[model samples]
Target: MISTQLLFGQLLLGLINGSFYALMSLGLAVIFGMINVVNFAHGAQYMLGAFAAWLLLHYAGIGFWPALILVPALVGLIGMAIERTMLKRLYKVDHLYGLLLTFGLALIIEGGFTHVYGSSGQQYPVPAALAGGWNLGFMFLPIYRAFVVAASLMLCLGTWLVIEKTRLGAYLRAATENPALVQAFGVNVPVLMMLTYGGGVALAGLAGVLAAPIYQVNPLMGSNLVIIVFAVVVIGGLGSIMGAIVSGYVLGLCEGFAKVFYPEASNIVVFVIMAIVLLVRPSGLFGKGD
Candidate 1:
């Protein structure tokens, strides 16, 4: 029998992983909803954020706290520029073009990083303040992991509130439904699209920053993770914000439990769940049926 401590520990780790999944999926959902573009470069942007944080620490003598704030902003700016200069031109074209362009961009970014940094993973020290753990009789909980969970939940909830409960969110929703109509109402739909793209990539960047200490900073880090996130997005239902959030956590926990019971199948558990979900509900857990 698995000890309670062991079970709970895996569950906690699952929740932490879920947090990142939720964040990345949220960004994907946002981009798809607003710009009608699937951002294959999102994983690259996430890698950029991790690298940005590392660069800041090595060259500028900055640390995690500052990087948490600055890295996402920098990435978001890069995303905005990409949208304005390159992605903007493809809006009138098929979404496949957008996907191909971003996939190409991902290859370029990852190749460049691999050339410069090599394939080895770089260690990012946990912040001094979060370097310890809490012992709760049954289990030892890493303080940093706890922080990741709390911070991710807050960020996810804040984003949801902004999108669902605010005037700006109303405009965004309106624009998503019919950009031309929104434009006729005097909203700057084009700029909004750019910003929405920026925001989505920014979320990816933020997740990267959070993941740095937990996972080694490496160019290929985001590639496999992004694939899993895409599965999460699909399982949650494409373009369903709440579905993405809930499915991320649910699937993460499922993966965690799978690891405990059938260690060999852990890696494929999420994909299995995704397949089942697809079969049962083609529209996703949270998505509306066509």
Candidate 2:
């Protein structure tokens, strides 16, 4: 039987993992909902973000704060380049083709990283500023983990607000519904689409940088988590930002509980929930019917 402390510890880890899952899925939703691409290469883009931060820190002595700011920008720029050069070509084609193209792109990215960085992983130490712990009556909480949780929450909330409330967000939502109509108002539909895609990719990259200190910086890291993220996205209902965030955390906690009572189930619990959600709501918890 697992001790209470261990259970809480696992729960904390689950929440941390969930936070990233939510962030990534939310980004995916934003991109797909507005830009109409499946973004199979999101995982690779995330890995690139972490790698970028690591390189900046190791070679240029950039610290966590700077890395946190700069890495996303770099990743976003790369995303824009990809969208402009490759993804834009598939806008009018069947989205399945876009998915296939991105899958191939993901493979190319992972393969390139593995060839250059090797199969071995690299470490990203938590900054001195965040290297500490807080004592709770039941268990000690790592300061860095707390920071991560807080940061993730704030970021998610900010994204939600932007999408639900601001003028730019209004334009984004309008564009998602009918780009041609929005463009008739003289709004540049293509540019907005590219920007949204870039922003979504940047979010993935930011998550990667945040995760590096907790998990090793490796080529396959994104691929490994991405499948599960898809499960989260499906369960939460694609194109529903709020649903993605809430479901990600709920499923993460569920998985954490499973680890205690039934270790074997921990691995598949998310999938089970996903399957159930699909059965009950074909459009997902947050998706709209065609």
Candidate 3:
């Protein structure tokens, strides 16, 4: 029989993993939905965020707290530059072109980092304030892990609210559906689209900051995780924010429970579920029907 403590520990770990998945896939959803970009470079951007944090710390003596705030903004600006310089030209063409462009960027970024840093990983220390854990009766809960879950949940909720309940969101949706009409109203649709892409890239950077302490900071880290994140995005619906958030957690829980029940299937459980979801409901659980 499985121990309750073991199950709870596994579940907690699953929740942590889910948090990352949700955050990463949420960025993918926003970019794809708002700008119609597949963003194959999202993983690379995530790696860049972590690397930026590491660089700021080791070189400039900046710490985690400041990096938490600065890295996203810095990376977001880089993304905005890319959108303005390159992505703008592809919007009117086939999506495959955008995908190809992003995928190429991902390869270049990853390769550049690999050449500089090699394939080995660097460790990001846990912040001093969140360096410990609480020992519950059942299991020890790490404070940083708990904070990660809470922060990610709040961010996801906040993003959903802003996208669904505000005038800015309405404008975004309207612009998506009819950019020419919005442009005619003096909305500057091009700038809006660029900012939206920047926002999406910022989300990925934030996730990287959150993940640096938990995972190794390496050139290939994003490349390793992005496939799973992409699966999460696909299972959740391509552009559905809620779908990404909910599917991420559900799949995490599924993987956790699978580990306890059938260790052999833990890795494949998520992919299996993704396949089933795709087969049953291609639009995803929270996505709108065509």
The clash numbers for all candidates, in the given order, read: 0, 0, 0
How do the predictions measure up, each by TM-score? Answer: 0.98, 0.98, 0.98
- Once fitted onto the true fold, the runs of candidate 1 whose alpha carbons sit more than 4 angstroms away are none
Model 3 Cα shift for residue 36 (angstroms): 0.9
Query: Residues 153-201, candidate 2, lDDT per residue (tens digit)?
Result: 8998899899889988999999988888999999998999899999999
Q: Native-vs-model 1 lDDT?
A: 0.91
Residue-level lDDT of model 1, residues 221-243, one tens digit each, is: 88969999999999998888888
lDDT of 2 at 241: 83
- Model 1 residue 112 CA deviation in Å: 0.3
Kindly indicate the candidate among 2 and 3 with the higher lDDT: 3
Tens-digit lDDT string for candidate 3 (1-290): 88889999999988998998899999899889888999999999999999999998899999999999999999999999999999999999999999999999999999999999999999999999999999999999999999999999999989989998998888888888999999999899999999999999999998999899999999999998899889999899998889999988888888889889998998888889889988999887777883
